[model samples]
Target: MRTEWSEFRESLRRWIYFRKVRFKRFLKARRAKQEDRLAKRNAPTLIPEGANIRQRADPRQSKIKRLRADFSNDLEETRFRFKQWKHFRWMRVRHFFQAVRTRLADMPSIIGFFKYLLHKRQRSIREQESLSTRKMEAKASSWSKFRSIYLPEWLRRWTIGGKPKSVLLAFLLLTSLVFVLAAYPAYGLLKALRAEQLLENSRELHQKGDLQGAFRKAHASYMLNSETLETFRWLCETAESINYHELLSWRQRLADHPDSGPQDRIKLVRTALDFHQPQVAEEAIRNLREQEVEPSEYLYLRLLTTLAHGRPAKNAAIRQCREILSLPAPPLEAYRIYWSLCLDSMDPRFGREAVNHMKQTAAASGAVGLAALRTLLQLPFEDEKKQRLYSKMLWEHPLAQRHDLLLSLRAVFFGHSLPETALRAALGKQYDRLDNTELQEVTSILNNLGFHENATDLLPTRTMASNKELWVEGLRARIGSDETKETEKVLMEQTPFTESERRFLHSLLLRKNKEFKKADEELVEALRMATASDLPILRKFVLLHEDKATLVALLHRLAKEPAMQRWAQALLILTLQRGAEDEPLEELLGAIQANDYRNNPETANRITRLKVLHGQDLVACRKIAEGLVARYPDVREYRFTLALCYQESDRPVESLRLLEGMLSANPSECPTQRLIGARALLRNGFSSEARELVVGFEKINLLAAERRILDYVLTQTKAKQKGPVLP
Candidate 1:
């Protein structure tokens, strides 16, 4: 029943679909007929003609017969037209050939006419040339007759021999000689002047620390004036910072100069030593003694060369160094060697003597004190003797009248504390004022030592108001602060600083606000305008800024610069360091390593921090820290890091000794230093000392966080003292 119902439904559906199709077709035919009738109604002009819609055709044979007769008439007309066209074409061709034959018959006459015209023109040109030639002949004859007949024979002899006269030749030769002589000296005078100018420019460049530019100018100057010791000295100084072989070539030039004196030779030897060319220094010293250099100068050079080349100085050498130091006005280098000898021999007398001499010398730039501090830096923390000496020297730095400013800097560098008020007063003590130069001397020392806040404080009141550099430096030193008055004043012309420089300082302000895009754009402009001198200043901005976004922009700008590409790779690592995120730093380093990324102190420190933070590569971390400490002894952070590395390496004694130096250098950070120090001491089983060290902090005021560290140190020391045993 279900199948039968389905078939019935299908049959009904098919019948209904066909009926609808047929109904639609019928409506279409009716609509077409209605449209045709409407067309005839609208026209009403010959309605029957519109209704027919086509010409009528008869079915009878009469209509076919009429059509055939008309077709025959059309064919007869076409044949007649074709015959006429064929006849016309033959007549046209015959006329064209007749015209060509007529023209060919006239060709001989046309050629004769053209030849006649050409001969006529040639005859006219010849007639004109002959007339002009006769006039010239007449003029030449008349001039010759006047000279030979009217002038005296003696005068004619003189005129004939004019160019070859002996007296005239001698005078001409003398004039040529004068010009040659005068011109050579003039050329040399001008060249010498230009060379002197270039030398001055090179001197300024070297002072500005643009080694490549300095060398370029110096090389040009030397090419012009190689005979001068001054030019050679400048060239050597500039090239010493760059290529060593080039420096040696210039050093040889200096030594080979005719005017090179003993002082010049000694300067060469010193430069060679500075360039790490001991063989050059050795060769120089060997020849210097015979040049009658002062005995003391020779001895100091020998000792300096020996010490610089990793060779130990003998007792004889030490005695000779003492004699040099004892001179009325010894060389500055002797005191440095004295510090070295003092460290090697463990002699306190030598140390005290060197210290006293550095204190008394009013002209000293604090080199001896720095040298002493650096020597102590190289010793291991396990060497208690060096540790005690370093502390005593670092703390007891006597601020003599001359050494006040520089020694404070060294003190700050070693993490030694100086009273802000005292340092400010001392800076203004002389001349009852401070200039940017002196302020810079102190500020640079402090900033390079990582005592940036102290550097900011030391800027004199209202000093940045009148000083553009001091203002910009203050802005840099005051990173991450709310201070903008000086920045605004400089930009708005509310201060005496220059407009051009203050505009550059806008980048630091932007960096402080974390507007890295504007900061990077401004830095890019500065880089475009940056001379070699401006670049060192610009790189410091990248080093100071910490944002990943800021560094990313800097990396793009620097990467496009071929000279700064290596720096770009280093900055790439520095950028990853900011987020401290998902990407592994080691993998990034390995990828950058393929690009030949050179290590700088800044990038090395960043990598070391990342390694330590991730708890990876403990050995490499310590080694890098050691290098950083050695390279930047003034940076207290590197020293502290190195101390931590020592602790990690199980050298607790070394760690404590290292911490002790920082503890003395920065005693104001008492709680923090003492905490780390006590822990290291406790780690080494010096629990009693650690306890006393923590107890001593009771006299100092500490912040809450510092107090927590104090309590923690106390707890650790107590735990170590009691062990797991019951009291």
Candidate 2:
């Protein structure tokens, strides 16, 4: 049935083609005949004029005769054209059956012609294959010799018969074992290169303030190349910098590492407690128990483990300070750890007791006093005695350059003014002693605390030019505050800045100058080069230009790509949420809840946040936040959010306690914890501390609204305080 239908269709197409050809011939013949007839009709018809030479000479009779001849020629042409149209209209109908018959008669000839062509093509293909085989045999050169000697049975047929695919499978199978055995150096090099790349990404994440991601990548680098001392050291430092849980994984390994020393063991034990891993701390203590160690070191290890693990550990940590100081010679870490534990208690009794103990210790060694003072000064009280002690210690510890720097950093952290000499002196000494990450922290502290000049001076000169990360930071600062005359020139220099980012900045300038049309054009070009990092910026630009079409286009394009699908969904969700697109948003949420198989933590976080915010139910919000906190324990932001929910739910004490742990764990980071802690502190009547906390960020760049809130909080805290004014 199918074959018959196909033949019928072919017959119909042939009939149409034949009719067209016949019409062409018919038109050609008809036009030729018409031309001859028109020529005869149009030839001047000589008619005798009514009888006279006078009549022949008159112009009226001549004009009338010419008009008649012209009309006759036009009529003949019209009639001929009509006849041509009629013939064409009837051509298909009149020749249909005749065309079918002719096509049927030619079917055998058409089939025979195709068969002839097929035979010729087969002969040509055979000749080409023979010629190709001959060429392949000729071209089989040095590699064939190597193959025959090394894996003789594997590829013998390929070379022997000059036939491709003859023994490739066998070749691969035989070569696999040998290559695996021989490829270590090459594999090692590849791993080293990949580790370096991951380390660079870690640095980028560090700059972006994604501490979780940064440390994760840094650890990944170490995992890739565990033999590299630099990578291992980087993994340790990054973990320390962010107070990450990965420390738990590497703590025991580090202790067992050959390069670890006595000091490293003690520090690791203390860090374990700081990371809130009491079990690891206890294990370290036990591990040290079987080994020979100094009495003071053993005592301190026992002290840390006791302070970390029970309900009374807080009071235990405070009471142990006296015994810790009574030793013949205390470990230098003892002073700092004792006072830090005191401050972490957030109790007045512990603070005063720590101070009393500190006075006895401070007179003996300013270094020890400085260690105590460093944690003590962060107490946020305007105590006259603490000030007097700080001033006295400044003179007493004249040789303690690094400690003085620590004291200065504390002062700067509270936005206190420092003498130029003291600031530079302390920073210069710090530059010599600090690690790379610590230097970045100090620079950031100096910068955010409004000592921009000191911060600028503190940037590491050795790697500034070569480190792309540092260069980017310096470039941002320069672009933000370069000499006015050089702003355009600085913006025009495009190295290191992505094209999309550069154009985005340029578009901002255009927007500032009220060049709306030009700004939109620049943004369109920026959208063309938009990267994953630039997605949020692209969305903002699109929104600014009211370019809904551009965003929808992005959504569509990103949807088709597997790697980009996650981002596409996120962008659409954000856009829909912003626009209050409720129906589609609900649909999206339903789809995600119903069957999303990706299992991405980030996507889950966003969805949970979206749901919690939309529902606006405190109970539901707290429940979700708690779940998120438990599931994503390493994500500091989620923990902070959970703290926030606790605070909002009127569990101020719990919230403040959690904040204290986080702040003690990692003081340099944890901005979110600080904010929530400040508010909780105020509500709990620790207004002085809250004031100091909120005021600490005043000099740092903040949004206007945030600055206003900080000022308001400061005013309220100051109103509650009756202590001596700060100098």
Q: Which candidate has the top score in TM-score?
A: 1
Q: Which candidate is the best by lDDT?
A: 2
TM-score to native of every candidate shown: 0.34, 0.31
Looking at model 2, the pairs that clash are none
| lDDT (Cα) of model 1 | 0.62
Give the count of colliding residue pairs in each prediction.
1, 0
- CA lDDT of every candidate: 0.62, 0.62
For model 1, residues 53-142, the per-residue Cα lDDT tens digits are 564433324433555789999999999999999999999999999999999999999999999999999999979866765665566676
Off by over 4 Å in 2: 1-295, 306-323, 345-349, 376-392, 395-399, 402-445, 448-450, 456-727
lDDT tens string, model 2, 1-727? Answer: 9999999999999999999999998997677667666765676645566555443332333333565689999999999999999999799777997899999999999999999999999999979966765675576776764563335544454456545573666666668878987798789889999999999999899889888898989989988988876677668778888776667667667777877666556767888777655656666776664366787778878777765533224455555655777888788877777776665553444667667776566666546666655544445557756665664565456565544554545554445445666665666755467766666666555544445445555565445544544444443333334322343465565445568866865665566456878877876787678677765544433443345545665574465467777658777776776555666665665555411422333444455544443433457556666765664464555656566677666788877665655543444233334666667667666777666656567656543333454665677776767433221
